[model samples]
Target: MTGRTPAPSDRTSRRRRAGVVVPHQPTRLQRLLARLVFLLIRAVALTLRRSLVDRTGCHDPLPPRAIYAVWHNRLALCLEAYRTYARPRSAARGLAALVSASRDGGFLAAVLECYGVRPVRGSSSRRGPQALLELTTWAERGYDLAITPDGPRGPRYVVQDGVISLAQVTGLPIVPASYRLSRFLRLRSWDGFIVPLPFARWEVILGKPLHVPRQVSETEREEFRRELQRRLLEITQD
Candidate 1:
């Protein structure tokens, strides 16, 4: 049951494809606010002491490409985490993150731009299929992919199937990553989003990569999903 890669035409005509809503473009005001937020977060992140524990072995020199599966709650410092640990070792030009295709997503997309990372809009809902195709295009162009297995909305730390599907189609390994902050606050969001305080110690843990075979059955995909969930939970600490 090998998943077929979407055809080149699928990549070329993705936006025009039926059922794909055009992603919301951020207005000028939103872009300005995003820059202010980015600067504020950058100042805080720079004050934190950070370290990486790479169980993946790929960190001696990161793989040319692999999907990073970070939990939704741990996203506050994810972009910085990439800049700290993955980017230096990554042979790829840059990273691309899957974001929601809503008005809120527009603001976040602008923030990603400030970090020089590409934002691929769409989620498990909204323009899902189109987003997947667009992500595949990014992968083909040599950008590493990042996804929150449970995100936009969540059942907390549960792993969703979309990451598995992306790996199947793109033939990239999935690397489960999590971080522990010595000081932090949990927001009242569905995922209990973590906001790390400045000047705290941060430990980013990268688990061994999980390779999803192109010919996986649905049952096997579920098994991979659970394995990812377990690894993420295992390495995470409050």
Candidate 2:
């Protein structure tokens, strides 16, 4: 028996499946709460005594563009770290970070906007393809990207394949960065979220960039993922 070619409708359906979906929009209440949270974050960030530990020159003076991989637990200081460290030295003018597409993510996206950071909403569970496409768009515009490999819910410090795929697709180096807080509270959350105490010493550590080849085998991608996980573990504090 001979095989039949797919119909035009079948091809159209496939194209639709590959297309990006619209991101979740924040509700009015979520927006309002986000503003309050942004104010609180701003107040807390200003009182911290911040420092940087960049042995790898990759972040001291950021490259034209790169992907930053930080642990999920250390996200509390991500914006502060960027504003204090990367933004000043980066040749890139904007930062676009991956975020979830849930209701909570809506609030977070708003807070990110408050910091002038663009949020690409999606995650492994929802709108994943759409988010990756959006991130690629931002990258083409010369914006630096950030992703918490184990974020939006996580297995703590474990790195996921999303970051690896992103690095491969964007052809950007993954710079592992983490934080050490002299004084802070650990929230009873999935990621043990950190809340820094007033006037505490906050350190941002950036590791060497791991470049992912544009063409890589599944085994190679896994290797890169493990390498990123190891580097993040090295820099992250419990």
Candidate 3:
């Protein structure tokens, strides 16, 4: 089953149907902070040497597209890594990431724009199902999707149902990815967020793709979610 294209004929109409609210516009201070974060990511990414782990056993090059899953805490580095290594072969507009539809997500949306990644606003907590549907539409429209499953808020490293549902709907394989840094700082955030220092070696893994059966029972969905979480943990040691 291929993913469905969004019902709305145009992007603006789709936004209205989702009942999406425009997040507060960034203040001057917010813009400055976004710039700083943007530069920080660039510098750190430049200093690190990286690699991709294909747990799925396919020896060919990275797939032209995938639903790349990473943890909430690793969002920053993962975005840059994707840009440097995975963005080229994707559709010209690049990867479409699922971001929360909230004030906080506004900040992230801006940073993503800086790096040329497109941010699709919505989350499991707000406009939740609609976001999933939109993501499926994006995947069908040829944009590789990126998701932080335990994100927007988390039970830390625990996978959510949304991603599994997405795979079922999109017929796209889930690629679990994570990175380990030789040196880093773990912020006291809910996910023990890591900010890798410059010059630290960053080793990334793109786990073998896990294909979700389109018509799974609830138990199967949970099982797949846990399996994804387990795969991510396998490559996250730092």
Compose the digit string of candidate 1's lDDT tens values, residues 7-82: 8556546855654477788989999999998998899999999898889866588777889999989988998999
Candidate lDDT (C-alpha), each: 0.89, 0.85, 0.80
Q: In candidate 1, which residue pairs get closer than 3 Å at backbone N, Cα or C atoms, i.e. clash?
A: none
Better of 2 and 3 by lDDT: 2
Which stretches of model 2 miss by more than 4 angstroms? 1-22
Q: Which residue pairs show collisions in model 3?
A: 55-208, 56-208
Alpha-carbon shift of residue 238 in model 2 (angstroms): 1.2
Number of clashing pairs, model 1? 0
TM-score per candidate: 0.90, 0.89, 0.85
What's the candidate order when arranged by decreasing lDDT?
1, 2, 3
- Candidate of highest TM-score: 1
- lDDT per residue for candidate 3 within 87-146, as digits (tens), equals 654443468889887777878878887877777887777777878887888888888898
For this target, which candidate reaches the highest lDDT against the unseen true structure?
1
| Worst lDDT 10-window in candidate 2 | 55-64
Better of 1 and 2 by TM-score: 1
RMSD to native, candidate 3: 7.7
Q: Give lDDT tens digits, candidate 2, residues 1-238.
A: 5587888666656765887444557879888888898888789889988888995665346677889888877777888898888888888879999988877888889888888899999998778987898899999999999999998778888888899989988998898999898999999999888887888988899888899998999899889889989988888877
